[model samples]
Target chain A: MAGMNMISAAQRFHAYANPARFMALSARLLMPLAALTALLTGAGLWFALAASPPDYQQGETVRIMYVHVPSAWLAMMGYGVMAVASAVALIFRHPLADVCAKSAAPIGAAFTFLALLTGSLWGAPMWGTWWEWGDARLVSMLVLFFLYLGYMALWATIEEPVRAARAAAVLALVGSINLPVIRYSVVWWNTLHQPASVFRMDGPTIAPSMLLPLGLMGAGFTLLFVTLLLVRMRAEILRRRVRNLRLAQAGGAGEV
Target chain B: MTRAFFALLARDLRLAVRLGGGGGMAVFFFLVVISLLPFGIGPDRELLAKVAPGMLWVALLLAALLTLDRLFQADYEDGSLDLLTMGLLPLELIVVAKALGHWLTTGLPLVVAAPLLGLMLNLPGEAYPPLILAMLAGTPALSFLGAIGAALTVGVRRGGLLASLLVMPFYVPVLIFGVGAADAATGGFAGEAGRQSLLLLGAVALASLVLGPLGGAAALRANLR
Candidate 1:
């Protein structure tokens, strides 16, 4: 009975792993996720742009933090998502995991790009420089951006899906180790960027006025990422089906 | 097992030496890139000396990149890589041996050539020891990390650019500490800070020595599959 129960549990876990099952689940959740993302983002931006108090030090320029900081958070968070999904794919041979990992790369890369662009915008007002190569956060974030581009490029280069996924998994796992070293090494190398303001051991130095909208924006951006990920995964699954179908019609080869 | 590993390593070393397109080519590339810099930046010795550590290091890096794809592709194309997978030698150990061979042939020669290139960049005398030492400690990490990239791209035709793209970002920490170690000495602070960066550079080398083989083996297995 215990063995039977375990077998049933495993079956149920894998039931959700089916691409059709994933598509059904994502279809149901997508509207809700997108709606919530829109609502939170709307309220958050209103507060961020209008209601939040200006930093005494930064004045109006601190407003850029609303868009910049959340995207930065989401950008790194996106890579974390990719790396975790890649790990699951590698270990369990879950088709959904590969789809999820592949989908997350472009979204993560967009967020990284946004973070860098907004960061340069913020730097211009604050540091009197459009870009600061000496800044650790900037450089590490730039590295992280390239890592995303590289991951996506690997997927594009390998014609076979399984080969691409596995090779990308290796890259992602290796990147997980390298990311921290890049972060720390840059810090030790030189640091012109400001030290950690929020998420400090001493508690966030920013006022509650800023923190609330920032939280709202962070949560909103995360949901947006999730929504986008679901959409991309759906498209990828459909694309693969079309591919398999074409191959079948031509010569009856490939896994369906 | 050790004998098998060395045999493979010896074979690669011989191929790199006999072919004359590995170490010799990299040094020549190094020389050309360094020469181009003086034209781009003008003949200002003061500026050249100021930028020498970084300039030489970057040139060495790009030169190493020029040879990265051939690290695994030759054997892969000729079916030797398939034999390697079936051999008594573990794939991870094969990876390490191959990376070691690559370092000896390509990376080490670049280290030797960097000082000569550094002279062209007007590198200060005080910076030379730390520059060489930092690179000596750092370039092995490059070869090892490059092994992972090379392995992933082994099966793809004209994968050299893709391999460099995937690999160069990981070279950041190495580049940072390497330049830091050299610059710390140039600034006359070699006692404390320079030692710290060099130590960190060595630490990166050591870490890559382990992680590279694991990653390279994983990638090679994936490509073979």
Candidate 2:
């Protein structure tokens, strides 16, 4: 049964590798995904804002973690997806992979911006400063924010689609190498900020009461990301098609 | 192959010296940036001393970036890069040669000028050697890493700013270690403490020296196509 499932999964992937099929499949999935996103996010917010207990030490301000942490999570998650998509685009030259990467940049940048803004909001009350250079995680988030901006900027600056994708892919791969360094630089330089709590080796340190809400929020954000990615990818595919059509109309110029 | 490598290196070095105020402009920009910092932040020498190491590294890094536009733009525009790409020498070697030339003309001057700027900033007497040493160890990595950004942005119009944006984040590790080494020396940590940061700085440079050329070569191939 497990082997049969794997074969079906592969077949599905192969089928959707075609753009027309992908458009149809994503269009079908979009409504269900959107419904799930709304359901999960509404529940997640209720649990986070109303049900979860305030922290013992941080009091009410700790409530900010729900919005802040999940956004940060989505920010990094979005970049990881872009990097993987870029790698696939580079190695396999898949048309969908290029669209996947290009469509993902702005979304990743938005999430990264949200993470920075929400993190600052969380920090102002908790850390007593609006910003702290001594905090490794926040500092790394800022660097990651810049990385996203550069990636998007590269895409915007290049006019040719294929050339842009290849160039942006190289930049994406190189920038990913620095992501870990940015994460660790504070430790190497001696951090004044808190160590990681949720994603630790020995399990999260937060209470179960808070953890459940955080988990729901995380799932909701991820589902929302998937919904948005499908929407954007479909739009990008259509945009490229329009460009090809226009080019063809203009004296049946060069190949698309 | 050996002779061709050195020949490329020699040719790049000659061009950097002969044209466009290459070495002098970068060092002068480094000096101006550091000098302007005192006015912007005030001339409280103690505060200046406190921030001096980091400021020096930041200035040198920017100075190196300013010179990087010339690294490939000239060769690219003159059609030599296309010839080089099609030539007997590998693209990675050419990247390495360009980075080496960039270091000699740009990185070396910053290393030499750092101590003078260090004095102007009222850096502690004990900090001078480590500041100079750290810059010496770290600036080569800037050139090498900057090469990848240069290659990636070569085909774009007015790509100098974009290249810096793409490249600046990568400089974080180098900055951290470079400043850390100087701070360790000035803070009077144990005898080996400063050495550790220096070693790490060297390690970063060595790693960049190896990986940067390959990445830059790949970017050049992609962008040139």
Alpha-carbon TM-score of each model against the true structure: 0.53, 0.52
What lDDT tens digits, residue by residue, belong to model 2 across residues A126-172? 64444444355665676676678778767765778999999999998
Residues B1-225, candidate 1: write the lDDT tens digits: 989998998999988776667887788677767756654655455677898888888988999999999888988889989998898999999999999999999899999888766754667788989999999999999999999999999989789999999999989999999999999988846568889999999999999999999999999989899
TM-score of model 1 vs. true structure:
0.53
lDDT of 1 by residue, A47-67 (tens): 999998888777887788888
Q: Pairs clashing in candidate 1?
A: none
Report the alpha-carbon TM-score of model 2 versus the true structure.
Answer: 0.52
The regions of model 1 sitting more than 4 angstroms off are: A1-11, A191-204, A253-256, B1-225
Top lDDT: which candidate number? 1
Which lDDT value does model 1 have at A219?
Answer: 90
The best candidate by TM-score is 1
Which runs in model 2 stand beyond 4 Å of their true positions? A1-15, A192-204, A253-256, B1-225
How many residue pairs clash in model 2? Answer: 0
TM-score of chain A of each: 0.89, 0.86
lDDT, each prediction: 0.85, 0.82
Q: Determine the C-alpha RMSD for candidate 2 after optimal superposition of all C-alphas.
A: 15.2
